[model samples]
Target: MPQPESQNQPIAGRYELLEEIDHGGMGSVWRGYDAVLDRPVAVKLIRQQSVTSPELAEEFVKRFKREARITARIQHPGVPQVYDAVLDESYEQLFLVMELVDGISLRSYVQPTQLLPVSWAAAVTAQVATVLSHAHAVPVIHRDLKPGNILISHDGTVKVLDFGIAAILRSDVTKLTATGTPLGTHQYMAPEQVRGGRTSPQTDLYALGCILHELLSGRLLFTADSEYMVMYQHVNAAPTPLRQLRPDVPTALEDLVLHLLRKAPEARPADVQEVYERLEPFLPSPGAQVSAPGQAGPAGVPDPTSIFRKPYAPRARAGQQSAAGQAAESATAQPAPPVPDAVRAAIKVAYSRSDALLEDDRFAQAAEVIGEVIEPAALALGSESRQVLELRMNRAAIWLLGGDYRAALPELDALSDAYARTSGPSSERARACRAQAARCRAELGQVTDALAALRDVLDVVRSVDGDVSEEAVELRRDIGMLFLAQGRTTEAHNILEPLHADLCLVLGPDDEMTSEIAEVLAVIRLDLDGPPS
Candidate 1:
């Protein structure tokens, strides 16, 4: 936890601390001004609590400084440029200053209701892959790759942040992160990371797989009541296939995501370059139109795919004639053909079969059945038609039920849009659709968005029905859980404590939902009380 330090204090005579932008388990990230350079910089104040004794602290400082230097050596646009690493004479605090990214954390984008387009998600992952390629060349393993550490700049560039835990692959350097202790976030940790096995580039790849899955599904790959459970899943469980979650996801893309999540590092993609190559097809091509009608557009945000599509894109010079330009002008694209009624009937039967399969927990079969109809339905009825959208939505639902979020998220988002467009935005159906999407976001680790969406839906539900309605109660419960996930225990307690009381009064003490809330509330109270001394 970061204590609020007074502002306007200049450290090392050059960097002036301004305000804290973010904080985490390791340290606080401050938005600082560099007096010498006359530019804004992000100053990370490492938490002293990470060390125990004086000798260990000294060693930690050395390792931190060395890692910072190694991080600076990674030359890539996707990585924030490292400016300086300063150690005070007292050695009480360590500061790392780097280029301040004007962007939102990737965590914000992992929303079930407003999922990124396939092209957008692919583009972001591809850029990350490119960055990893460069970093691996210098033999630096990020060691920690999570949504929190990835920033999407206003310019649409993906910036990888926080190399604090990064390990330089040098034989002479002492191992700072000792054996028998894992160093990454439990949710994104690779199997090897959980087992305290040697971390290589493959370790980062595993983390990337977790991120990509979350990005695609709007949910984390795995979750549990405790960190130990999550770690156990990482080491022992198999990831649900993306196609089983979202029928719209390309088979190749789903295969790639699964490949990246392989328990054995060797079974994963050979390198980040290979990952990038695999992602190339999903990325927007040069001069290709990226947005479509009825789809969520970039809405003024920079497009990440623009880098690969139009590197150094510039305005066409006045009266400058180009052969490629002429060819592009002469070419005209064809529209998709309409779907026949016979195909529609086939789609309906497939959907029914899928529903039955889903009930039996045959997620793969359910998804495949629906998937077989999606292409034909889209082609015949138009991709955005109500029937086609419903088919897609059903497929997404199957994915969600099967715990294949990456596959489900995009479908839910598209369905949300379709429902809003067809039925009014505030319609009960639309709200329900949005709520389901938010649930997916929560599962994926987009706590802030999930809380906001749930609250919004809860307000509507309460307005239409009442505060104690099942929908409202469920929304409140979800909001509280999201708060807990964000480590805002007080807020979680505030919400869950009341909600649980209400549930006990209305639904009875032994009701499943009430009991669930009670269990969570008890845990929150424990957290609020602090550990037994």
Candidate 2:
């Protein structure tokens, strides 16, 4: 199969493939950028290995497009929005563009040393059940519902992935294997599924039971050396009670798992709703304390129960102040002896190298070039020397350009404070730094604070330079785009409509800035009002 030749190459002339997210037997996924949409997206590229002949190829394309369309029909927050599906002209590759979900998978939460708390397990299972209910209602059976296929997003929303993908991939696998073995997750497969029987909502329930059991027991429900052995266990073996492994497990909860693991599809819970109901007793109620000692997952893992505890809560802002930011706040920059000639020359060389690297779109390497001289330069000319601070700012900018927002955010925050300390808060350097930090915040998904920061900067800009000035225009445009990102379309349209008119008046309708704003306004108008009659 043909692979992407360049790391930064745009796929099909629109989706710029940045970094590889993951790879599997089928193909790989990329953290891609949509040039047209100006947003980050997850792109799954399907390889052509399954299509052995032209006839199979044509059918593959038809089935792939149909599955993509049906997957998009699942209108739930738990389902990542499918933005587009692109089949390459050569039929060599297919791309599924989807909303980028930033979260730890349940696989990460499964640790033999620390099984999840009862509430945590229940919270995750309940959320998945809710998502399953939505998918099944659309008559979409997730033929392969496994822990890896589920994601707990940062905001604690449980997202189900690849709804129609299993059905498509199963056919491909069966054709290749020519073995009659069923093609679902062996550990989570229902007895009927193991027998190559028809799957339904009950199959999904069986998978959910497997997930819940693993979450509570920190082990697969059935384990063996080979896929065939695991499949056989699913069909014939009886599962051990959860309490036997973890006596703290409630008897009722254990019973629920046994009921779900029943060999027959008809013997399982009636539907996902029933599974959700059974899980409710172990879930944290609204406003209830979500954690107890030993209840937390691995450090840095988000609390899934936060959704029920504070339903519909805005994403908790990223760390307001990293440790370095705090130190920068408490310690003042002290003047030191003049820098030596050799150190200054090294700093200059580093800057030249970084500038060249950046020109070639080698952002990470560019940041590294700057980083190499920062410590030596700081040692020779005080830590907060103009030369050292300049290097820090440039590196941080490179990180932001590279889409390393987490690395850029804290540095930008500290840079803003440092600039304000040296130059007054209203000075050009300080305001500019603050504005850049706000942009970092926006990219990091702290929309509320980011919007507030940008507005503050805009107010300062308008007071000095009029609202139509270059900086003011850019800030206004950014605020409108931010609002649009948050799904406040009417507000976004209200902000951008007048802004577009102003851009046209000042820069003319054909100007690049004016045209970009006009394009966004066109999209917003289309969303607010239906398509033309």
Candidate 3:
């Protein structure tokens, strides 16, 4: 075994590495500070604990450097900005200084809070989407976003903690596959990704769906007590309904969450922004607002056009072996139907310990452990308790990751209702339900209805949460994405750029949002600047 290095030692004379904060297959994080800047910072030291060969170690350092450089390019309100990356003496280690987030992982939050009220769960997810959008904007994909990587501050500020597995979508493809790193979380992997296929914005969307499910349920979405079982489930099993577990969930919103849980990548929403937009309405208060009696002129049926654009299923890649691969894959890999009581209970217990399996990137193990818990728990425990609501959310999220969006919807709706009662109309819980509902509608080609649903919350959201928080920024970003998807390039640009600019100013140039907005702009350029108007 490699001996642990002494805490509080100086590395490169620039950063004082304090206590060990965390360790991954890639590196160890430490509570450290910059001697020059004087502000405390967290330093992640890339592990050189073992190398199959000394030659590989040299190659490892180079790969790590290349990866670090790509990470440094990211900027987002919800992602830690890396300030420095360097090699230590004898070039034994590589360390990166990142903004220290003063809170626990989302995992910790779920355990103690267990089944966060719906709005709050949506809030966490929205912030995550904000981070993802930004990361993807650099055209970089956070191939490994999970609960542990999501950090929430004491005051509720959130940041995504690692860039280790971030994949740059640039021409530098050589760097990613060079060391043959088997990147990403298994349970959260999109169907295309799971099949060792192409990746796009939709890949991250699948992961977020899983993460969102976990946060809402305090549970994992897939399980069978083994990695293979979990991977098999992700590839083949259908998820249990979220509402059946959480009886209080609203039907409309739950429908949306399940849509994200679809089994085929092409069946899932085209991008993460779509998820955010769909979910935003449910994030607001549930009580409908009456337009103050006889209020003003021209109050025709609400403009359904504003909230959503059509959400066609994502087209399979051009060179894909079959143009109807999505249909064929779905037909061939139909998921396992919900099983009996005995089987369900066993699965739930297995899925609850996902964190234990995360280190080895045995995401399949973690997922299986988590997924198995859902069905049995719903059977053994009444669906109305806090526990059930939590389980439902998790199951729905897994369904989302599996590309079983239809299955996830019911759970999201159920969660919204429970949160409405638990946290009340004014809280973030209520808002999550509204937002998630919108996301589902948008994904299902109910763009008009999706926007309308989102519009339904505008009044309540504005009243309760008010404008200008990160939550508000995320909502705006969602709308921007909706516009872009519909080819309303100018409209999308106008809404997103200013918000993007604001994120840059408040969070700095390296924030995740900075990259997300830029990426959106890049897409707009390709879609609008070079195409038929």
Candidate 4:
């Protein structure tokens, strides 16, 4: 359900930001839904304060666009796919729409009392290296790579997040520096980054080393009282070897960590390939039973090596039908038994509550009220049954009224076809559904498709109830307005001229609807005649 703060308004007319997922000094990330695609997305809203001046704002926009394009080119499964980059008209808000990765951050797994298994740490690190290898090939350096930016997805695949975010944030950091707003995690920052030097793939390797060290030792590689002290330690301090903190760590793995942590960029391993090679020794072989090496490190941790153990394993079979799936499948799957009396009564009550919610302008909650009864009603009455279909139509109306056009569009389309199949295409219900679907398309800026859909419904209405019917008049007005919006003034005039005449004949020129059409036609005529000579 959408929150009140969002009020169903979409970002850039596409993504509807739902809930704040994470926040930092730079900006906040939101769990959002992409209305046009009907899918979930993660939206990162960059802080505007970073762009202090006109020149910096211009530079930031250019850099943000460039970074977004490069980030999209990485093309690795470990990297969350970038869907789009949006800068609002005023350039005050910047957003990056990305795949909503469902996973646990590596930060959550790095508790002081809970050391990760040696093989697990190597598996996670190796995966990160593989991702870095691809990104580095694209010549992208992840300026900030830390445990918090790494995630293990549900299927045991590592996801390196915020691929180009740090670079975008750094664009305006020089201006923000005076405000004492730091740009990166100091503990995981590379020495070069700390010293304000140029960064390359080697810089990311240093951060990866910090992550591996923390994963193995169950603590940050460096600790200090302040960010300055942390940066100072990063530049001057020698990282303690992993084996010293975790005796079970293999010598070669510790050596690789040390290799990654080398202060000089050129002093680090040649590339991520070399780092992965050293890690290969600790990684489990294909189909190998993976377990913590030497000692149990942590309980209930998701095994990162499962990708190797069962590469591309098939989806697990569900033992029982899920209620969500059941509800969806019941639509057009097969007819079930008739609705029980108790459920029928409950559906009636639900309808009343949903109507009240809709009157209050709580569209999401209105839809939710109907949704609560859909599953049970669908299970008993069957999907295409009159009662169930009515419930779906009402729920879809709520979505449409809420300005969730993407959510409503598909459901309306489906319901239209269902009505046509069950009650005949020219039936009032079917025609109404088609008109509603057109309205959704129009709202979503699909003007061409919306016009065609509206025309088709209007033709059907004319055949059923004559051209002067209320529905016919409304559809004609909608089609004319769409043409006018597209600047097809002649076509709009032609459509509305006849429509306005009919409204006056049927409802009288003084009627509200008739007068509104008269007003629209008056404006169209003025535009046609070039503004009263």
Clashing residue pair totals per candidate (backbone < 3 A): 9, 0, 77, 0
Q: Count clashing residue pairs in model 1.
A: 9
Residue 190 displacement in candidate 2 (angstroms): 1.9
Task: Residues 382-481, candidate 2: write the lDDT tens digits.
Answer: 7777888899999998998889888787788787788778876777767777888899888877898999999999998989898999888989999999
Q: What is the lDDT of residue 222 in candidate 3?
A: 77
- Return the clash pairs for model 2, or none: none
Write model 3 residue lDDT over 354-451, tens digit each, in one string. 54544444333344456556545555654555565666565555555545455455556667877788777656866776677677767767677676
Ranked by TM-score, the better of candidates 1 and 3 is: 1
Work out candidate 2's RMSD over C-alphas. 10.5
Tell me the deviation in Å of residue 324 in model 1.
31
Cα lDDT computed for each candidate against the true fold: 0.79, 0.80, 0.64, 0.81
Estimate, for each residue in 136-243, the C-alpha lDDT of model 1 and write its tens digit. Answer: 999898988998999876556799988767888777543677724788899999998888877899999999999888888888899999999999999999998987
lDDT of 4 at 61: 84
Top lDDT model: 4
Runs in model 3 deviating more than 4 A are 1-9, 89-91, 111-114, 171-175, 178-181, 285-533
Error of 2 at 509 (Å): 26
Write out the backbone clash pairs for model 1. 216-406, 217-405, 217-406, 219-444, 220-444, 245-399, 246-407, 338-380, 339-380
RMSD of each: 24.9, 10.5, 23.8, 13.8
Best model per TM-score = 2
Model 2 regions lying over 4 Å from their true place: 5-9, 166-181, 291-294, 318-413, 420-428, 431-533
